[model samples]
Target: MNIIVTRPKEDGSPLKEKLETMGHRVILMPLLRIVPRPRAFIRKLPYQAIVITSANGIRALSGHTELKSIRMLTVGPQSMKAAKEAGFLKVEAHGDLVGLATHIRKTLNLTAGP
Candidate 1:
């Protein structure tokens, strides 16, 4: 089988290696690049939980210590792990954005302000 991995290089490497070991030909064609932006002073915002849809978002937010204490809702396992590694103590992994939103809607009241 021939597999084309469109994830970023760092993310695709392990999967490519695994697929190769499984007797499949893998091609890495990164679809996106993560570029860190200049540090910005983040103000304290009223939110129940921080929602992240991508591992890149976790990486981008890693330098912002203000969000460390807030709960995180990530879209996938990899993003969840990344959030944890980035010092998020409270993290939840959902299969997709809709799932995350549904979980949040059910778990929290909008009137409570996160």
Candidate 2:
């Protein structure tokens, strides 16, 4: 079967390869382009934990090895894997925004520091 993947190049390329391995014809038609902001501009805030929703966030936070000590909550498996690869000691994976919010509320002391 022929499949058209419309994800970004970074994400679509992997899916294309996987499909080819499965003997499916995958045409990668990347519709989105990621323009990463300056990594230096990203700084750690005074928060108890860090919440990341995208794998790109990991790339953006590159070189901040000290941040690996902070607890991290990611939106999906990909984000979780990225966090782990980035050497985050404490990482939680959630499926969606609501789940992530619930986890934060249950785990974090909201009345405390930001």
Candidate 3:
């Protein structure tokens, strides 16, 4: 099958090898790029938790002292995997944003307009 792997180019390379080994043709079209935040920039946030939807977010936040204390809510298995690999210990797998938002609303006990 002609499979299109849309992960970032660097990450996509590994998947491509695995897919090729499985006899599937892989196309690498990265839909996003990961740019890390400056180390100095991380010193300014007062966040309680980190919300990450992409693996790029994991790469961006890696090795920052500020994030060490913040819990993480990540979308899908891949992002969760990346976040964990990037040293996040307190991570929540939220599946997708819509589901995450629903979970957040419930967890926070937020109600819709009356």
Report the C-alpha lDDT of model 3 over 1-114, residue by residue, as the tens digit: 999999879889889989999999889998977766575464455555677887777887887856855788888888888888888888888778898887777665334321
Candidate closer to the true structure by TM-score (higher is better), 1 or 3: 1
RMSD of 1: 1.9
Estimated TM-score per prediction? 0.84, 0.79, 0.71
**Best lDDT among the predictions, by candidate number:** 1
- Which ranges in model 3 have alpha carbons more than 4 Å from their true place? 14-22, 29-33, 43-46, 109-114
Point out the worst 10-residue segment of candidate 2 by lDDT: 37-46
- Report the number of the highest-TM-score candidate: 1
What is the overall TM-score of model 3 with all chains considered together? 0.71
- CA lDDT, every prediction? 0.87, 0.85, 0.78
Q: What is the lDDT of residue 48 in candidate 3?
A: 53
Q: What's the best-to-worst order under lDDT?
A: 1, 2, 3
Candidate 3's error at 30, in angstroms? 4.0
| Clash pairs, model 3 backbone | none
